[model samples]
Target: MKLALVGDIGGTNARFALWKNDRIESVRTLAAAEFATPERAIEDYLSALGLPLDSLSSLCLGCAGPVSGEDFRFTNNHWTLNRTAFRNALQLDNLLLINDFTAMALGMTSLRENERIQICPGEAEADRPALVIGPGTGLGVSTLLPDGERGWRVLPGEGGHVDLPIGSLREAALWQQLFAELGHVRAEDILSGSGLVRLYRSICALDNHVPHLTSPAEISSAALAGDPVAEEVLSLFCIWLGRVAGNGVLSLGARGGVYIVGGVIPRFSAFFQSSGFAKSLRSKGCMSHYLEGVPVWLVTAEYPGLEGAGVALQQMLDTPNAA
Candidate 1:
């Protein structure tokens, strides 16, 4: 019956809610640009919810960066936090901070039967490691390692910043072009929201057409409206995503399931379903059969970050050392 405050803090938005009695209540999302500091945003959310400061037993935050000691700075936003200071200010017994992808990996545990849709066909093994990846403002990667009776523990890292691998002659050309312009073409270079735009522009230039730079939404809309260039961008995006996912699966030895959790994937589900995703995933030369039985699923749960925070807090409370 413990009450906790949970937040999924990202580059663009910070979502807050109260986890009470195994459920989230008073969920609210605040624009990161609207608040100068994280404390200010917390205060505003608390005021909006009319929640008492003393009622919160713990505060758990899923941040979009590497957490070191008591301080962590957001990857996309300008906000920084000193965890010890925040805990003291809130007068809470505990504060938990974890990488955002770690939150997503943990969030997969709370997913409902109806909340997820299978993309690739496979027989997922029970008690095996699970991988969760997504592309939004940036690409994220994390895996859930089964810890026997302790459940799954999240293994998070900066996998998205790794070097991108080109699968074809066309991709090689695009990669060279991007490398020339950006000095280094990372996996996130053409795998994120801004990457969608970059792909569209790169295609425009490749075909000797004037590139009208647009947002990811515009590109998606244009692709749906029968724009050949936009369609190509999405197609390329899906292919790359699948290839990277396949590599991720092999690297992590993930057999339970591979969960796709991000804002961008759901936006173009139909295209992703019909695109070269499955084919590309199984296209790995020597390891083709290794991923044959590993299932791929898209996470459609609402407010998974908050739920993930709740899971982290429950784990903390369960630990004997915490007592």
Candidate 2:
């Protein structure tokens, strides 16, 4: 029997699972910092399951950062992998490495209705592309395009680093401070986990309010507890996320829908559902109506990246000329 392993590796954590019978099993998440290299982590995972290292015939990793060349270094961590060295070490017949967000885009294929929370209700045009944007350690953006005979093709880019769009006078004021301090304020600068703290601090400075919260969790907790300053920060964070999501949809014509997948939003799902996000998303001046029927969903699946790794692997192994 041909056995395969799939992994969704990020800066903070690395989730691994066995791919069998078209599903994921024996799922495990390991701290990225604990292992010297990704290979060691994989070996440790297999060993914990009492499985032989050579039992796996194929390995697929959906890793953070650009995937190319023989030598691959993780973006947020110190781990690196030499593809040829890894393939030889593992005695694998096939090895595939994909951008973590590309795997995230592919993971949307397996989402069931209950697995997602609808942020905006509308009909999805199945033939059009879908936008997948989320924030964790950083913001990630990718487009899932219909490939006709090829099923789906993922278009991955550093859309997170785009200029931060200003929507209101208050936001413009915040931007001025951020730009003054950081020089260039990218979308990821305000939409990520750490970005949440940055936004909170900047807001405090603008309002002459002493910042009582220093982390995303603390800010979110304070917001939920009805602290005025924290509440404003969380609200603006969601609104800005909406603006960015709107931009992505317009750029890709992603009427197939929008899947918001990441760690940050899900932390405050209820707050996000009721925030100004919906209104901000459709706030485009003349093109507002263009986004009318575009559906948006917040993904709630626990291991989507790992599941997407499996999908990517299957696609690659089945296609003879895939590159």
Candidate 3:
């Protein structure tokens, strides 16, 4: 069994690791901006490990964007790749590219007890689909369903770009302002890391206060410190996240469970768990019962996408014809 390289590439950082014996090793994270191309970043990672580029048999990446055609451009980063160019450049035999959230959804299969904390308690029905979503540099959404052969299949989509759903007068007022300012208010407009700041500023605008927080981290910190304005921002973030998750659940019939995995939510997990997320998720009129008994968990695994990339790579290797 030859070693394979797996990566989880997001807007901010690129993480690489070696997959061997069904585990991850030689894990290294590189800032995407530091290198001109992914190949260079991988080469640096390999060089630090005292390994040659040819040592690896294959490479699989979970990137933050759509995966298609011979040419691929990253959604959040400046790096782009031509499949033929990348393969020849790396001198690799096999290469697989998948949606980062697809890998994230697959990562759910490998979560341990401590890696996940339950946000909504319910029974996960066997054979039902599970919803995997996260908000980071951008929002990501994917679905996971049992393959009936003891394996799992991932269905990836751009669920983040959907229209922002409004459920209350407060949200409607905020949405109106966002629409007037931005023209189009997608869910990602207020559901991502930058979205936190946008939501904060919007609330500030509504309340006639000057904005104090500039970044997601600062806003979360202030909220945790009992700042009223920041607390509203964080609370609204969780509520909106719940709305999006609930909508996803309705679309995919995700009765298996919901896994919220991302960089932002974990920053203030305690506040998130205590917010109106649950209420908003189940607040759908008439169809509210559809969400009953579906478990929801917050994933805190550091590198689930890396592990998931490895899983996807192994599956491809096992079935060469798999698309």
TM-score of each: 0.95, 0.97, 0.95
- Candidate 3 C-alpha lDDT tens digits along 69-173: 999999778999999999999988899999888998988998889999999999998799999999987898889989897778998888999999998899999
Answer with 1 or 2, whichever has the higher TM-score.
Answer: 2
Candidate 3 lDDT:
0.91
Where does model 2 exceed 4 Å of error? 321-323
Candidate 1: tens digits of C-alpha lDDT, residues 137-164 = 8898888887898567998888788888
Global local distance difference test of model 1: 0.85
* Candidate maximizing lDDT: 2
Report model 1's TM-score to 2 decimal places: 0.95
What tens-digit string does per-residue lDDT give for candidate 2 at 75-123? 8889999999999898899999999999999999988878899999999
Order of quality (lDDT) = 2, 3, 1
Quote the RMSD, in angstroms, for model 3. Answer: 1.6
